[model samples]
Target: MDPTHADLERFCAELKAMWEACGPPVLTSVEKYGGPKKSQVSTILNGDITTVPDIDNVAAILKACLANARAKGLEPPANAEFDYWKGRLGSLTRARSNHSEPGPAGNPWRDLAGTHPVWESTTDREFFRPRVVKAAAHLFDRRRRAATVLAGDDWLDETLAQRMTDRMGDLLTGRLASPAIRFGGVEASLIVLAPLLHQVRVAESAAALIGVRPIELRPSASAGPLRSDYERFLAGSEQSRLVARTELTGVPGRTGAKNEIGWWLFHQWVMRRQDPVPTATAPHDLPIAEEPLRTVLAGTLDRLVKLFHLSPDGLRNKERRNLVHKVSHPSITPALQDVRELLVGLLLVTAHKLAVELTALPSTIVEHLGIPNPVDLGRLRALLTGMTWQPLEVIGIGLYAQCHHEAVLEALLAHVRQTDAVLGSVRDVATDRVHLEPLLRLPPRASADFVTPAPHPDNHTRPAFVVPVTRFRIDETRVRELLMGEQLYSDRSLAIRELYQNALDACRYKQARHRYRAALEDT
Candidate 1:
């Protein structure tokens, strides 16, 4: 109705904290500073007023507090604090007016059907229950419409009809009125009704496509539940009388028991009818029909390059393989196999690009880039020789000829050997030298050698070696400075209000849980 007594008390406590934190200046000093007297401030802070304080008085007190904060070198209160209080005051004023007026007839609390069992508090129940009830009612109405269509064919047997009647009666009279039927239960029951409605709709669509004669097939004495009827329709095992009564004249396949009647009819009418092909130039660039397939392929390639550091071997690791499977769509079983081949192809392409770039480098640059140490040169050659194009054959088999594969493999090997020879020659030269140290050092002609840079005066000023240090602790002096500072008052009150509201909400939640638990114990 209005701001509750507890809410007002909480607001007063927050106001007092803000005032005290601002130095709680003497009442005479506040009066001298063009603000209300100390007694008025105390009355406001102590929640002594019969009504909420005037906005002007509140503003004056805040201004005085700001003055006190500035005088003490503390941060002044923020404008946001004033704005928050202004909004609260408005709400309280409106609520007070509403409290004096008569309420509507129905009890909002009793009318609420706690349909969602997951509701953590009474407030959530009150807020969400009505919305859930409306949605369920909408679904129920749609289900009945579908039922009416099915009833024309005499599909509604006596037992099935009675079951639907009872369920609808329970929904309208009992569950809708009772507070016990939670959102979860209502949702679950709706799911149970969905399949029956879906089957009926599918049957109607299939019958229309096949151009079957309309027969008023009612439920016979031998009819079972709606679930059974739906199962029969889906399985294509329903009686021959329910199947397409007309000859499937143009349709090719002979009717069989194994095939579902609706699916057969749909396949004949829809699947067999092809639309004209588009004349657009880039037909091959059409979007993938399966979104998950594209997503998995893109993600796999990205992760293979970035996360796995472009290492083809990393793709074969158990962890990476498992991740691929985990993200793959369950419907696409060959997704993993396709990913493996594509990853191998991508790796080969990357290797080919690298080889081409390396071979393009001038012989002078390549010689200068050679490994200086014999041990390093030996390792380089071993690594290069180990690079084989055997895996590319898996991708190139039908995609490319054997001769082309061999030619590409030979080119890759030639590049590796040429690079290895450059390193080997450098290693030999370094070994033959009387002093290898000079070869390892930067040449005297280098720019770095010509320009001598001065060292930084402070070790801490050097970016390479400098490390940052931070210490955290509560300081009253700093806090006071902050309170008196200009930025202090801005967002402080809004934050405190939110925190206070959350605390009150948490209390209500615990109370609701306690009540729920007690109810469970009683039952």
Candidate 2:
């Protein structure tokens, strides 16, 4: 082996034994004048949960590994990107650019690579390995999976150590029939401590155990993944909100709107499933529609078909068109089309499966109500005006009260104005709107990040609420609630100010260019 590579290899093996300390920081000797004199990955993380890594213990080990690798005449990674054991690490680099008619070289990572050299604390969610959790209990649940510390002041007696090893087996592995193996103290401890113990077990397995007391455990010092953003993302708390902001800035394609086309594409890219198979089949009685909307599915689908090129699948303008497209339907009224297609498209596309589920229900619910269709209601009322048998009046009132028909709602609102019992109609209609109903928003939902109610598409809900997809705009307020928080207004992803800036810049650029050409002609 090459001596450099061999030394690095040896250093990597030896550094694993030294759990804690700055012995592994590769660039530590390079020396900085301000801020953190020595910057590694975890130290850069501070306390943000979103940026922690899955295996934090590897910080020191990775540091040592990098140093040894670099000392052996290997190059520093061109910034943070590298591949190890088929796994890739996201890297950010800072370096000086080439000579460009100047004495001073500029930082290449900042100037050319479009990144800042000074590392900042990250905010990312973390995912824990459930298997590691299971394995911790697997190894330690016996005899409460106790750790035996040496009692002696120094290294303790070797014979005592050997005997202690036997005692550990007896404690953990011995068959205990007496006292029914009372788990009084440790049972609750297990519930609270099981997860922590598992982390410890995982640490121990890597030959990177951090010491633990009976009640407390500290994180192991081993290797620095050196990418706090990614690490914290994996190690952060699970209690994070459904809507989260990441340290990552800028939209993927163009101007970095949170709603930017590029960001939207990236969202879609991450949610795409390479495999076509589903985890389970849908329900037989799946209600694809909600109340008044369920009552109007066919009528609505009829109007939208030519506009959407609608078949079974939802909207079909183009896959990547903006949510509220400027294109107008030739046949429909523009205002209705705007609300029906734009707002409704936003609503349905967001909760499309719910819309589909709402619309999927049979149109016969209108007929089942024993009332004439809105198309025929005027004539029906005229015929019923002079008729006898007041019982029909009772049936009519009951049906009107139950149905979510807009005409019914309008009539009832009128009736309520005349006499307030009709407010019951509005309240009943609005209150009962939330009853669980299946509506097919999308057959195979293309985006995992699309906002919808919880309890999953695979799961079922109750009696059809038959809600309009537009009614679902109530949920967008929730998105607004997340975005308009005190700390989040400045987030570029959520900010609208940049959009104003883009418009202003375009106007200024055009005016300035015109003036520059005019000056050139005069000269």
Tens digit of per-residue lDDT, candidate 1, span 1-523 = 1234544665577667767778875655656545677788788889877677788777777667767776797764322145446655654453343233222322111112223223421222443344434433333333333333333221121122112223333223421344543222212222222222222223334333332222212224554453234334433422233343222424443322222223333333322234321122111221334455334433443333222122234433446433332122354333231222222222222222222232121222222111221011111222222222221221210111111122232333444444333323323333444333222221111011111111222232443122124423365446755765435656667658767999999999999999999999999
Q: What C-alpha lDDT values do all the predictions have?
A: 0.36, 0.25
- After superposition on all CA atoms, what RMSD does each candidate show versus the true structure? 36.8, 31.9
Highest-lDDT candidate: 1
> Which tens-of-lDDT digit does each residue in 1-523 have in candidate 2?
2222222333233333331232344444323211223444334333222222333333434445445555565543311111221021111000001111222132121121111110011111011122222322333322111212211111101111112222222222222223332221111112212222222222222121112211111123543442222223324332022112221234342221222222222222222224321211111111322332222322332232222212232232334322332233232212221122332232222221111111112222121122222212211222112111111222221112222233333333332232222222222222333210111111111211111221211123631123254532244445656666535665756467866889999999999999999999999
Q: Which portions of model 2 miss their true places by more than 4 Å? A: 1-55, 76-280, 283-523
Off by over 4 Å in 1: 1-3, 32-35, 77-80, 101-523
- TM-score winner among the candidates? 1
